[model samples]
Structures are given as C-alpha cells and as structure tokens.
Target: MGKKSGKQNKLIPESHFRLTHPSVSPASPIVDTHTHLASTFELYRHKYPAGDYTTVFDFVRGLYVPAGVQDIVDVWCEAPVRPLWREFADSAVTEEGRRDLWGGMGYWFVMGVHPHQASEYTDAVEADILEAMAHPRCVGWGEMGLDYHYDNSPRPVQQEVFARQLRCAVRLGKPLTIHTREAEEDTERILKAEVPKDHKIHIHCFTDSPAFAQRLLDWFPNLYIGITGVITYSTNTDTSTTVRNMFAVPASSPPPRLRIVLETDAPYMVPAPIYADPAFVAPDAKGKKLPICHSGMVPWTAGFVADLLPRGEGEGEGAEGWDAARVMTVARENARAVYGV
Candidate 1:
C-alpha cells in the first residue's frame, strides 16, 4: 500500500536550496514525528532524482537531510493504507529498499482508522489494525480521534471507534496520536475516561486555544502538541494555540515547559518558506503540480518555531532562548521518547 510513484520533483542539490543558512554545522537534526512519508515523497514528484539514490528515497536523502532533518514517523491513518504500510515497512529493511525507500534515513510508523472513516471501522478492521501494530516497524496507534469540524463520520460512530481504538492502543501498550478537531470537550472526556494514566499521546497539528493546550498538558504529563508548518503561517485559519504555548515560558521565565514536537503533515501543511501560492507554480512532468509539502521543509519550520519561542533566560542549552538548534534537539529527543525509538 505504500508504493509511491509520480514525476514530481526537482533535480537540485543541497547547495542550490535557499531554505537554510550555511553556518550551522550538523545543526540539531530534526525528527518529523508525524508525516505521510510515502505520500509526501510522491507529492513532490521531483522532475529527476536529486542525486544517485533511487527515486523513492530522493525526497528524504536529497531534501530533508540537507535541511537538517534526521528521522520521521509515518502515520498510516486510514484503514486501506495498512497493506501499503506493510509493503513500505517491508521495503525499508532490504539493501535495495534501503537505497530506494530510505537512502539511509531512519523512520518508524503508527497506523489506525481515522475518524473520517469511522463508519468503516469494525471488529475485523480492529483485529487487522492490532495485527499490523504487531509489526516491528509499528510503534504507536493513531491519528485516530474525532474530527467534528467536518463530521465526515457520524459523531456517534466516531466516538465509538475512537474509544474502541483507544482501548486497542492501551491493550497493545503502544503510544497514541489522537486527531481531535472541533470536539475538544468530547475528546477530553474520552481521553480522560478511555485512556489510562501515563499513556503517551500526541494531538496532531493542534490549533486549539491556549487554555485547551494547558488543560490537556496538565492532565497528561506525557502528552505532546504536534506542531507543524501551520505555525509559520501568518494567518492561520485554525488559530493554533501552539503559537501561544511557544512563548509561554518567557525567555525571562523558567525551563522549557511544554512537550512540543514538529511535523509536516506533509502533502498538506507546507511551511511558508517553501509553500508557494497557486500562481507561483507549474505542473510536474506528469501534467500534475503536486502540493508543496515534505519533511525537507522541516528546517524552515524549526527556524520559524524558534523565532516564536521565548528566549528564557540562562546561559546555554536548557535556558530556553530563540535557539533553533536547541528546539530541534528537544524535538528529536521528544520523538524518540514518544515512539521509544
């Protein structure tokens, strides 16, 4: 199910990129804790391979590494993508697959039935999901909460499946990445009731209010807010509270207090530095101009996030400042902790 193909890409080198500054050597490499790795790679659909690596790994090795990205956690959030995920995971370990799929980058996975497709969730589907979770490559369970904004699936069905999947994650001892939108109250309720204490959870691309962010962070110590390129947008449609949280522990305040991680939600949330307007682009080789989003944009995102963070007073590392390097380091470490990598 993870097979990716499309002639959407650029035959460029790290030197040609303008998204990064050249001074930082081995700058804090990033870990895009959440992304659709395969989907995003194909989304770029490079015109030609950036280097000698095979086509599939081109986006990662060519793009992300150059931009200071180190790892990724690909989330398979729909029912039908499981088989593809299996294929991708299988391909990741082979020598040829290494050249083709990873090009030496490290990645992990999480899979689940999203709330949009809640109607399709069932006992069989649940069993299959759990079985897939057993894969060595699988590290967590989710992108599986409620999305009341669209209500693509009935609220009732969504809740039922949400709770069901929560139980499954808990049963399997895997961390969770819940996707809750416009249903914060219900999400909080379900999380409080269904998820056990100390379970690792991430609210993907959070755009809620600061109060909501504080409430959940206090409730779940291990909970993390999945920040994305959305924060870089001057006018965020969802009004992410992460912008607030980032500045909370005032540089004049104390230690870096929030558990925040960066992600691209690729093929969707493109960082401003890399995102071009509709008229700013042209179609790819296949007569398709794919959206501009990928793990490669993460460095820009990290820089954007660093600019927003409070320059908490102190000398070095822990003394939170607008240090992009520090932020990137924390994010990488947090992802490893979350996925137990």
Candidate 2:
C-alpha cells in the first residue's frame, strides 16, 4: 500500500510520477517478468482509475517490441475462471499473429489462488489448478502469499493455501511467484516451514523490511526479489518521518545480480501519478488513464535504479548512459534463474 495524503496521493519514486522521457536503450532483451494483459482489458471495461486498455496490442507492437522486451509472463491463479481465460487469450491468435505478435502465442503461466481469490480454494478449485498445471505453458505456481491489509481470507487459511501451492510447485519442479504484503512475518514463517530444498521462489512486489529481505535471502538462497516502478511511486507517506519501505535494497549494496527481476503489474499498479495527469494521454482513450502500462516504461523504472545505484559506479548509465542495458542484463539473468530461460 502507498502513503495516502489528503485527496492527492504522494507519488512514490518507484511509481515514476514525473517520467515522460524515454531512456536510451542498448538493444538488449528485457522481460516484463510479471504482468496481466487480460486483466488490463477487464479493468478498462470497468472504468477504473487508469482504465484505457484499448490499443494495447498496437502499443506493444510499436513501442515494446521496438524497445526490446522479448516475453511477458501472463500469470493466473483462479482455477475455474483462468482455464477459460487461457483458452480465450489463446484463441485470439492467428497463426501469423501467434508467431509475430506473441512470439509463439505462448505465455508462462502461474497457477495458485491470490489472497483475494482465496474464497475459491475449495476441492474443486484445487483440482482445476492441478489440471491447468499439466499444460505445457504452466511455468510457476503463484502470485499468492499473505495480504494483511486486505484480509480477504483468514491468515490460517491463506497459509494453508500457500503451503499446498508450494507443495505443488515442489512436485512439479516449477518455481513460485509470491506476493507478500503486511503479513510478511507469517508469510516468511510459512515459507521457511513449508518450502522444500531446491524450491525456486520469487517474492513479487516485495514491500517488507531490508532485514526481512536479508532473512529471506539466508533462508531461501534461491529466493529472488522483484523490482518495479512501485519503488518510485510508493504511496508511503511515511517517507517524511521514516525512510522508505524495508524491501528496497539500495543499488549500492546490490543483491546478487541474478536475484533481481523487473515487473509491470499493469492496469493495476500504474507506476506514478503521471498516469493521472492530463497531458500524458493514452491513444484511443476516452478521457481515461492508460490501463495497460506500456512495457516501454521499464527503462524509466531503470532510471530509478540508476539513481539509487552507488556513486562512482558511473551512475551516468541509468538515465543517460547504459541504464536500459544495465537493468536488462540483470532482469534477463533473473528470468534465466527463475525459469532457466
């Protein structure tokens, strides 16, 4: 969650509020390790805050493809609903479109109920998720963990659900994408207790303390940290009284380059307040904010990384120099680590 200020939310740095300029790229393959193209369409249809999902494919074809993003893992978790969704997304592809637009019309899939969908974790749901995993595209086990702020499900039930998913990942030899929020302590405890040896784990949109991050690193050596524009757009109003959130690792004391990944949780966490601005308009938009954040923004996110990186390390590489190239190198390595791509 971000810091709330009077009616206008204070835009967090990770959110990239003032970023209108594009960073220079070095022709590297950057992967949006996490995103939801389908969800963006849905959010826009409902008229959410940044609900202009039209022209997403055109944007990707023109902007992101030229920008160098190779693949976007379209993750899902609801058992009953997602199987149909997967088919729906798949059916839209023409043979040529599949190869050209989607690079094979294939997406890395993650299966496990999110905390919000925890209510669906019944016997039938479990069966459906298991069946989905059998598909060749299923790559990981979740975007699931604990969310204390929105106690959508009881903590115990969330834990049980998480444990079962972890077990499923272990059996399948697939990595896991985790979503941890205020429930960091319990989330960590359950992970420590349930995650098996050789299990691959990625804590997506991590917002815990650095100490907790360190502990997780120690406990799960294979664990990785996902960085997003959220760092720039963090709504944490406490930035005035306290330092930024704990999950952020200064680029100075960098984690292993392989332990980091880049993500754009589009249609949902549009990086900064700039999306709320009028001048930065979305194409084909009807007075609505851009819902599917163009993957081109990853370079802007890298600018924040360059800003945080220690001085004397040629900081020029971020905003002006090799910033895009540098972030892409680490991001691709992270993908390789997580999926052995």
Candidate 3:
C-alpha cells in the first residue's frame, strides 16, 4: 500500500504463532497442515533450542518419523523463507543419501509473505510470490494476515497486503493460509468482505476466542482450524478456552463443523512432552529444550488433541487410543479436503 517495509521473521531469524486446544497417536497418520522448514541457528539457539540436526531434511527424518508424523506442509511465511523451503525439498531429492522427509510422511508447502513483514512487501516480491503460486509443490498462499500484537508492520499496510494476497490466491487457483493474532475483529471482517467463505482457507495456528472460532467456522464452511503445541501448556488461557468450549464441549452451540487440522509450526514450538517434559529438558536447562518443533511432533499434538475431544464418539469407547486415532483421522481428512494433495 505504502513504501515497502522490512523485518525478518525472528523464527526464520531467517522467517514464522498459537492454537486454541490441541493431538496424534501412532494409530492414525496425520497431516501437519502448517509448519516451517526455513531455519537459522545462531539467533534463537540460546533462548529456544529447536535442535542441532544436520539439515532441515535430517531434522525431519530424525525427529518427525519417530514422533509418528506422516505428512507435513512446510510453510514459508516470506519471500526469503519461500525459496529456502523449496531448496530443502530439492536437496533431499538430489543429494546422495539424503534423508527422506518421513517415509509415508510426504512433504508439501505453502508460500507467502507474513503480516509481520507486511511493510516489506514490494511489487517484485509480490510477483515472485505469485510465480511461486504455480509451482506444483506450492499448494496455497499464506502464513499472511494481521498481527496487531506486534504491529511490526503498520495496520494499514498489513490490511492492504493481506487483501492483495487474497486476490492473488484466487487468481492462482489456490487456497490461502492465514495468521491472525490479537486482531480478531479486523481479521473476521476482512475475510468476510474479501475472501469467499467457501474458498479453501486455513487459519493456521488458530488461537482466538470461542466465539471467534465459532464465527469463523460459521462464516467459512470450508475453513479449518490449525491446532498446535501451545495448547499442551496451561498458560495459554485464550487457546485453551477456545478449544474446550468451542469445539470440545460445544455447550453453547455445536462445535464448528469445519474440522480441525494439526501442525507443528516447527522450529518454534514443539509438542507437549517434548515441550514440557523434564526428560527432554536438561536438568541445567536455561530454556525449553526443543522449542524448535518438527513434523515428528505432529502425532503427539494430534494425540493430545484427540484426548481433549468429547470421548465416545468414535468406536471402541474407553479403548486406549481409539478416540485419539479418530481425532487424527479427522485432521488428516480435513487437510486433504483443503489441500487436495
């Protein structure tokens, strides 16, 4: 809208947010609807130690498969990170003895500029993103929206760029993945006014209020909630309430018919046990051990989410992992419907 702005995503230091409630068990394969493979070690290693894996490729192989990850969409939130993701995927194929992503856990991705770096948008960047839209591996547009929390980019610029990308997604015949934080009213208003409700869209790492969740689901029949590891912790009251009350309990109204999808939003947030487990943490730990998450952790998040869902809906009620498996199944199905890959 105005002069382009610039601020590297702290995650990508190099690139990348929250979820309401959260799952997976090994029983059901999962699709990590959103995550980031673009990496940087020096910036965040001190406070948030993701891991010291060889390449992003090796990271996924060594971590995700063991955690039960079956598929993942490694999201790139900006231009720099976008190419980085493709490079990793390409390298995995061309490099000798390179790690396969996760056996059956295939790789897919979405590319777009994030709202945090909204001010940095330029005509050249937009053209690059649009071109990437046609890429076979590129399934959607985003990790773009508004982040009033930081307002790294001015509000007006954020709105303009978000609107622009919405049109771009429609033009490219693809869906959109959004990241909206602390700007619920504007987020809803924009999506309602601009993007079609039936359009394929993923509210990646959703962590708004229960009403917000319902409104989004009510408004967008095709939308799916992106659940993440943050739900595993107790401090995220907003996310916890949104998940429990909106979908899990369904006290006020039936939970959003739009199914939920799982994600790692990796290299930032790892799932429960690894996120908070003492075993994963060093006794002399100064910060979280595996704050940098990977697809491997999706199953754990899926499993955790399954545990939170209303019990007994699935067969084998009270069975050890049946319900969780059912939840993961729902996540996988939802992801397929939206991504169509």
Give candidate 2 misplaced runs (Cα > 4 Å).
1-27, 45-63, 88-97, 100-106, 237-258, 273-292, 312-322
True-structure lDDT of candidate 3: 0.67
- What is residue 28's positional error in candidate 3, in angstroms? 0.8
Q: Tell me the TM-score of model 2.
A: 0.74
The sequence of per-residue lDDT tens digits that candidate 2 reaches over residues 223-333 is 877777676665643221111222244667533233567777765555554354444463433244443464556665655555454433333323233354666776767
Residue runs of model 3 more than 4 Å from their true location after superposition: 1-27, 40-52, 79-82, 89-104, 246-258, 275-288, 313-322
lDDT of 3 at 135: 67
Provide TM-scores for the models: 0.81, 0.74, 0.78
Count of backbone collisions within predicted model 2: 20
Q: Considering TM-score, where higher is better, how would the candidates rank from best to worst?
A: 1, 3, 2
> What C-alpha lDDT, on a 0 to 100 scale, does residue 293 get in candidate 3?
60
Put the candidates in lDDT order, highest first.
1, 3, 2
lDDT of 3 by residue, 1-341 (tens): 13322211122221111112234455476667887656522223443355355454555554566556667787777754445665655544422524444344566778889999998888888877777676666789888999998999999999998988888887666888999999999999888888876898888887777789878977888888788988777766666566555344434654334267878676666666543543334333424243356555665566666666555452332223435567677678888889975
RMSD of each: 6.0, 7.5, 8.2
Strongest candidate by lDDT = 1
- Cα-lDDT of candidate 1: 0.72
